[model samples]
Target: MSVPISRLHVSHDAPLLRHVSEHASRTDWCYMHADVASAYHPCFSERLLQQMLQTQERIRRNLAADPDPKAGIHHLVLASDSDVFNLGGDLQLFSRLIRGGQRGRLLEYAQLCVEVAFNLHQLYDDRVHSIAVVEGDALGGGFEAALCCHTIIAEEGAGMGFPEVLFDLFPGMGAYTFLTRRVAPVVAERMMLDARVYPVEELLRMGVVDMVVPRGEGRQAARELIRRNQRIGNALRAMNTVRQACNPVTLDELLKVTNEWVDAAMRLNDRGLKTMERLVRAQQRRAQAAAPALTLV
Candidate 1:
């Protein structure tokens, strides 16, 4: 049976949710990103990811049951939350979901997204390229989501990191696996442990972000990346493959380490802990400042 698209706890009081309901286009940026006004209406919504994953899973099962050397599409460019990319899983909403005996459903959604990430990783290993463009802050699960892409393009001052660590929680969406792969193990650890928000420039220098562009020009630069680097993506995929082949540790072995970290994170309690309060408040301030003003529908 095909997996069902899991429902999200979209707040009825949220202005953005209302915007989504009003503006015919909710989250699909397909033709618009390409600047084809004619193709605008068919924009890719977050629903697109769910649709793509379900289709891919079906095809994958068919292939595994048989064996097809040739299958799958070539390129896919997805737009994240307006400037923020994604705020990861809605922790506030998640708290309510978990309390409602819906943790399994949430877990299922997380697992599906994680599987999609694995597919992207394998695509990179098999010499296929995927690009993710970040226009603003990509926090917690959002950061992990971007890590799944082969090429990550961020805005000049964009913020990126696994801030979930600050919440006394571990990344349940495959952030550990991808972060270690993209940046040095030591550097990734430092970011995870400290739960600091680093600038895109720092991330780019550390190899966490592939490229940084000026504000309002990130999408343009990303398109140019596709134009200029014809074989660059393929080359990167091959390089990653070679490195994995040469590595002594297998993915299974790495997951064990990740589990240990998860266990430790679960034990943490940010309740009454002011450890990251300053940073958290700062982020909140920025979010409030940048948030588009609108009354709830």
Candidate 2:
């Protein structure tokens, strides 16, 4: 028997939830909500990432148990809070890791991120559609995470970009791989090295964003897109499969870049880490300011 999704507990502390509705359809949208005022942003903690991984595993198992394919989740949507999608990596963690010379731990984090990027990019077996809903700023690793999805549905005022260059490091998890797949390598390189935050509209124009909707409409747009595509779902999946076969995003490449990232991280001087620390403080401030009406969905 299929279990009720609400009762399906992947992790008690996962800071995410599942709901069922017509618009939700065969879609599993997990919205992350947590206090940014905490030293660690909800999205970038080791504990949170582990919970998320467990949740995905559980979801996959549940889907496999379900006999009806259409009744199962056809799409997975990642939603975030209203003000900031994510501030990227936990700067505090990075600062400590870099200073303490915790190379292995840093690599582990990178590997975790790669696993996340690859699994989402593959759409959990290519049978499930994947969409990223960006309602606000998605920076650095956060932007890379969004790009890993098959489609990025962002609000009109949402923003995304790589600010990693400013900190003397690159977004080595999946930015280069995903962005290059979507655009030219030169274009990807320029975008990353420039360190500018691009608006959702500009990204939509550049073909980076699949859809841009009004504020508070990202979830609606994602559901609507899935519904519209359902008519030709078979064809859509077939085309994506063919594309993957032709030019696959390989794990080897992800690991290679991640290793390079760790090495570069070891070379960061005080100046770079200071910049990262400042960013961390900025996140804390944002969390404090938005605490009253802050929400994730």
* lDDT winner: 2
- RMSD after Cα superposition, model 2: 4.8
Tell me the TM-score of each prediction against the true structure. Answer: 0.63, 0.88
Off by over 4 Å in 2: 1-24, 34-43, 68-73, 295-297
Q: Judged by TM-score, which candidate is best?
A: 2
Collision count for each candidate, in order = 6, 0
lDDT of 2 by residue, 122-231 (tens): 74555677789998899888898899888899998878999888889998988999998788999999998999999989999999998899988988888788888777
The models' CA-based lDDT, in order, is 0.53, 0.75
lDDT of 1 by residue, 11-85 (tens): 333122111111121111221112121211111223433554544454445435534344332343445434466
In terms of lDDT, the poorest run of 10 residues in model 2 is: 1-10
